[model samples]
Target: MRVTILGSGTNLHPRRAAAGYLVKTDNLFLMDFGPRTLSNLLKTSADRHQIQYLLFTHYHADHFSDFITFFFDAVCHSKFVSPRADLRIIGPKGTKALFGTILRTFPSFNDSEFRVTLKEVSTRSFSIGSTRVTPVPVTHTDRQTCLGYRITFQGRTLAYSGDATYAPNLIRLCRDVDLAILDCSFPKNRPGEAHMHAGECGRVAQEAGVKRLVLSHFYPIADRFDVKKHAAQVFRGKIIRARDCMTLSV
Candidate 1:
C-alpha cells in the first residue's frame, strides 16, 4: 500500500496546504479534500483520473472545501470523451445534506460527465474495491460530525485521524496500524480544545501501539515549537512530521 500526504497544514498556515491524503492499493482512495487539495493533488505522483473514492472526515471548510473544484477538474469540458466511472464519496452523518446544499447553491455546475454517489457512514466497516474501510467517531467541535478512518488492504493497515481530539475511539481505530497519521494542530506547550496537541498525539499513538506515527495538520504556532521532540517523548516509534507531497509505503 502507498500513502501520500498531499497537504499537511491547517487553515491558518500559509506555507503548507490543508488536509488531503492519497492512498493507493487496489484502487485510488483520497482522504479529506481541503481548500488547497486540488493544487496539491497535481503535485503528487498520482493519476487524478484513477481516483475512485473520497473519504471525508467532516464538512469543515479547511477539510472539505475542494470538493467542488475537484469535480470540476475531473470533467472534460472542451473535448468529447467517454465518461469516467462513478466516484463514491463516503462521509460522516449529514454528508448528503451538505452536498445537497452545495448543488443547490451552484446551479450552473453540471454532473453529466461523471456521477457522484454520496453515502453517510459511521462506526461501520465497508469496502471500496479491494480495500476495507472503517469509520470511527471522534471528539471534535460540538455539533460537528468528525471521524477517523482505519483502512486495511493486502495485509497492511493504515489509520488517519482527521481533526480529532484525544479520545478512546481514535485509539481503537488506530490500534496496531502500520502507519498512523494524527492531527497535531497545536504545540504541546499550548494545547487546543478541539484538536490534539503534540503530546496528546504522541500519547495516543503510544497507547495504540502504532509502528509509525505521522504528526500533521499543524497551525502556524507548531512551526515555532519542537513537535517531533514532544511526540518522541511519549511515543517510542518512528515519528514523521508530515509535509506536503510526502509519500509513505506500507
Candidate 2:
C-alpha cells in the first residue's frame, strides 16, 4: 500500500494546506478533502478520475470544503474525459443526509454521469472491493461525531486518526498497525483543544506498537518546534513529519 500526504497542515497554516491524505493499493482511497488539498493531489501521478472511494473523518470546513470542487470536476470534466467507476463516499452517521443537503444546495451537482453512493459507518467494519475498512469513533468534538479509519488491504494495515485527543479507543484502533497516521496538531505542551500534541502522539505510537508514526495535521505553531523529536522521546520507531505531497510505501 502507498500513502500520500496531500496536505499536512491545518486551516491556520500559511505554507501548508489543510488535512488531506490519499491511500492507494489495489484501489484509490482519499481521506479529508480540505482546502487546497486537491491542488496538491493534482501534483501526484495518480489520476483523480480513477479515485474509487471518498472516505471522510468528519464535516469540519477545513476537512470538507474541497469536496465541492472535487465533486464538481467529477461531474463536469471527468464524466466525458475519463469516466471512472462508482464513487463511494463513506463517513460516519448522517453522511447521507449531509451529502443530500450538499446535492440540494448545488444544482450543478444534481446529475452525475456515474453513480455516487454514501455509506455511513461507526464502530463497524465494512468492505470496499478487497479492502476491509473499520471505522471507529474518536474523540474530536463533543457536539459532532468524529471517526478514524483502520484499513487493511492485502497483508498490510494502517490507521488514520482524523482529528482526535488522547483516548483509549484511539490507541486500540491503532494497535499493531503497520502505519499510524495521527493528528499532531500541535507541538509538545502546546495549549490546544480537540487534538493531540507531539508527546501524546509518541506515547500512542509506542503503546500501540505502530511501526511508523506519521505526525500530520499541523497548526502553524508546531513548525516552531521539533515535532518528531518530541514524538521520538517515547516512540523508538520510525517517526515521520508529514509534508505536502510526501508519499510513503507501507
Candidate 3:
C-alpha cells in the first residue's frame, strides 16, 4: 500500500498547510480534509473520483475545514464524480451532526446529487473494504474528543496520531506497525499543551517498536530545530520528516 502526506502542518502554521493524507490500494482513501486539501489534491496526478473513503480524526478546523471546498468541487464538477462511488465518511461520535451543520451552513452542499454515508467511530475496530481500522482515543482538548487510527491493510499496518499530546494509548495503538505518522508539532526543547514534541515522539516510537516513524503536523517554529537529532535519540529506525505530497510505501 502507498500512503501520501497531502498536508502536514498544524492549524496555526501558515507556511505548511493543515493535516490531510491519502492512502491508496485498489482505490484511494482520504484522511482529514484541512484548509488546503482540495488544492493539494489538485497538485497531484491522482484522480479525485478514485477516493472511496474519507476518515476524519476530529472536527478541529485544521483537520476538517477543507470539506466545504471538497464537497463543492465534487458536487459541481462531473470529472471528479465517482460513477460507482460510495463515499464512506467515518469519524467521532458527532460526525453526523458536524456534517449536517456544514450542509446547513452551506446551502450549495445541501443539494443531493452525490451519495455520502456518514458513520461514527469510537475506540473499536471496523472494516473498510480489505482494510481493518482501529480508533484509539487521544487527549486533545476538552472541547473535542479526538482519536488516532491504526489501519491494517494487506498485512501491513500504519498508525496515525491525529493531533494530540503524548498518550499511552497512542503507543499501544502504534505498536508493531510498519509506520507511525505522529504529530510532532513542536520542537524538542519547546513545549506545547495538546501536541507532541520531537523528543516525545522518539520515545514513543522506541517503546512501540514501530519500524518507521514519520513526523508531521509541524509548526513553523519547529523548523528552527534539528528534528533528526532529537528524534534519533530514542527511535532506532527510519525517521522521516514529512513534507507536503511526500509518499511512503509499506
Candidate 4:
C-alpha cells in the first residue's frame, strides 16, 4: 500500500496545511478533506477526480472544509469533460444528514452529472473494493461524532487517528499495523485539549506495537520543539514527522 500526506498541520498552523491523507492501493482512498487537500493532491500524481472513496473522521472545518470545493469545483468540472465512476463517501454518524443539509442549502449540488454516494458509518467494519475499513470511535468534541480509521488492503494495515485524545479505541485500532498515522497536534510541553502530544503519541505507538509511527496534525507551537526526538523518548519503533506531499510505501 502507498500513503501520501496531503496536509499534516493543524488548523492554527500557517505554513503547514490542515489534516488530509491520500492512500493508493487497488484504488484511491482519501481520509479527511481539509483546506489544502485538493490543492496538495493535485501536486502529486493524483487528482481529486482519481479518488474512489472519501472517509471523513469528523465534521470539523479543519478536517472537512475542502469537501465544498471538491464537490462543487472538481465534480462539476469533471461532469463537463468526462464524469468518472461513483465517488463513495463514508463518515461517522450524521454524515448523510450533513450532506443532505448541504444539498438543501445549495440545491444546485443535486444537479450534478456525476454520481456521489454518502454513507454514514459508526463503529463498524465494511469493504469498499479491495480495502476493508473499520471505524473506531474516539474521544473528541462532545457536540460531534469522531472516529479513527483502520484500513486493510493487500494484507497491509494502515491506521489513522483523525482528531483524538488518549483513547483506548485508538490503541485498539492501531494494534500491530503497518503504519499508525497519529495526531500529534502539540508538543509534549504544550499539551492541548482533545489532541495528543509527541510523548503521548510515543506511548500509543509503543502500546499499539505498530511497525511505524507517522506523527501528523502538528500545531505551530510544536515547531519550536523536536517532535521526533520527544516521541522517540517513549517509542522504540520507527517514527516519521509527516509533511505535506510526502509519500510513503507501507
Candidate 5:
C-alpha cells in the first residue's frame, strides 16, 4: 500500500497544514481531515469518490474541521461525481453522534442520496474487507479515548498516532510495525504536554522496534531545530520527516 501525507504539520502552522493522511490499498482510507487538508486530498493521484473509509483519531478542530467540506462535496455537491461507493466514517466511541450532529446542523446535505455509515471503534481489532484495524488507546485527553490506529493489510502493518503523549500504549500500538506515524509537535527541549516531542518519538520507535518512523504534526517551533537529528539520537531506524504531499510505499 502507498500512504500519502496530505498534511504533515499542526493546525495554524505558517508553512504546513494540520493532520491528514491517505492510505491507498484496494480502496482509499483517509486518516484525518483537518483544516486546509481537503484541497491537498483532492490533489492526490486518486479521485475523491474512491475514498471508502474515513478514520479519525479524535475530534480536535485541527483534526476534524475539513469533514464538513468533505461531506458537502462528496454527498451533496458532487452527487454525480463518478460512481461513488458507500463511505464509512470510523472513529472513537462518539463517532456516530458526531456525524449525526453534522447531519442535523446541515440539513441541505443529501444524506439519502449517499449512504454514510458511522462505526465507533474501541481498543479492539476490527476488519474492513480483508484489512485488519486495531484502535489502540493513547494518552492525550480525558474527555475521550485518544486513539492511535494500527492497520494491517496483506501482512504489512502501519500505525498512526493521531495526537498523543509518550506512553506505553503508544509503544504497543507501534510495536514491530513497518511504519509508525507519530506526533512530534515540539522539538526535544521544547516539549508539549498533550503531544510527543521529537525525542520521545525516537524513544518510542526504538522501544517499539518499528522499522521506520515518521515524525509528523510539527509546530512551527519544531522547524527551528533539527527534528530528525533529535529523533535519531535515540532511534537508529529509518526516520522520515513528514512533508506535505509526500507519498511512501509501505
Candidate 6:
C-alpha cells in the first residue's frame, strides 16, 4: 500500500496547509478533498479520473471544499475517466446531503452523463472495493459530525485521525496500525478547540503502538511550535513531519 500526502496544511492555505491524502493500491483512492486538491494531485502526475473512491473525514470547508472541483471534472471533462468502473464517495451521516449540495451548487456541471454513488457511513466498518474502511467519530467542531478512519487492505492498515483532539476512541481505532497519519494542527503551547497538538499526538502514538507516526495538518505558526522537539519527548517510534506530496509505502 502507498500513501501520499497531497496537502498537509491547516485551514489556512498558501501559508498554511489544507488537508488531503491519496491512498492507492493500483487503484487510486483519495481521503479529504481540501482546497487545491486536484491541482496538488496533478503535481504528482495522478489523474483525477483514476480515483475510484472519495472518503471524506469531515464536512469542514478545509477538508472538503475541493469536492466541487472533482464533481465538475467528473461531469464536464471527458478526458478523465474512472478505471475502477465506478466512483464511490463515502462520508458521515450527511454525506448524501452534502453530495447533493455540491451538485446543486454548480448548475453548469449538473449535466453529467456519469453516475456518482454517495454512501453515508456511520461508526461502522464497511468496504469500498477491496479496501476495508472503519469510521470512528471524533470531537471536532460541534457544527458538523466529524470522523477519523482506519483503512485496511491486504493485511496492511492505515489510520488517519481526520481532525480531532485527543479522543480515546481515536487511540483505539489506530491501535497497532501500520501507519498513523495524525492531525498535528497546532504546536504544544498553542491550544485549539478541535485540533491536536504535537504533544497530544505523541502520547496517542505511544499508546496505540503505531508502527509509524506521520504528523500533518501544519499551520503557519507550526514553525514556531518546535513540533519535532516536543513530539520526540513523548513518542519513541518513527516520526515524520509530513510535507506536501510526501509519499510512504506501508
Clashes of each: 0, 0, 0, 0, 0, 2
> RMSD, each candidate, Å?
1.5, 1.1, 1.8, 1.2, 1.3, 2.0
Q: Which residue pairs of candidate 1 clash?
A: none
Model 1 per-residue lDDT tens digits across residues 1-250: 9999888997657999899999999999899989887788998778787787999999888888888887766665312555567778889999988877775576444544667788999888999878999999988989897999999999999999999999888899889999999999999998878999999999999999999999999999988899999999999999999999899997
The candidate that achieves the highest lDDT relative to the unseen native structure: 2
lDDT scores of the candidates, listed in order: 0.88, 0.91, 0.85, 0.88, 0.88, 0.83
Summarize candidate 2's per-residue lDDT along 1-250 as a digit string, tens digits: 8999989998758999899999997789898899999999999999898898999999998888899999988898756777667788989888999998897788678788788888888887988778888988999989879899998999899999999999998998899999999999989968499999999999999999999999999999999999999999999999999999999988
Could you tell which candidate, 2 or 3, scores higher by TM-score?
2
Once superposed on the true structure, which residue ranges of model 4 sit more than 4 Å away at CA? none
CA deviation > 4 Å runs, candidate 1: 77-82
Candidate 6, 1-250: lDDT as tens digits: 8999988896665654489999987468999989876677888877777777999988888888887877766766653553223578889999988777776677765556666788988787987668888999887778878789998999999999899889788898789999999988888998676888899999899998998999888877776777876777999998999988889998
Name the regions of candidate 6 deviating beyond 4 angstroms: 79-85
Model 3 CA lDDT for position 30: 86
Q: Residue 25 in candidate 2 has what lDDT?
A: 79
Please tell me which model should have the higher TM-score, number 2 or number 6.
Answer: 2
Candidates sorted on TM-score, descending: 2, 4, 5, 1, 3, 6
Query: Which 10 successive residues of model 4 have the least lDDT summed?
Result: 103-112
**lDDT (C-alpha) at residue 28 in model 5:** 80
Between 1 and 6, whose TM-score is larger? 1
Cand. 4 TM to true fold: 0.96
Tell me the lDDT of candidate 2. 0.91
For model 3, name the residue pairs that clash: none
lDDT, candidate 3, 102-170, per-residue tens: 877786776646677889988889887788889999887888988899988899999998987877888
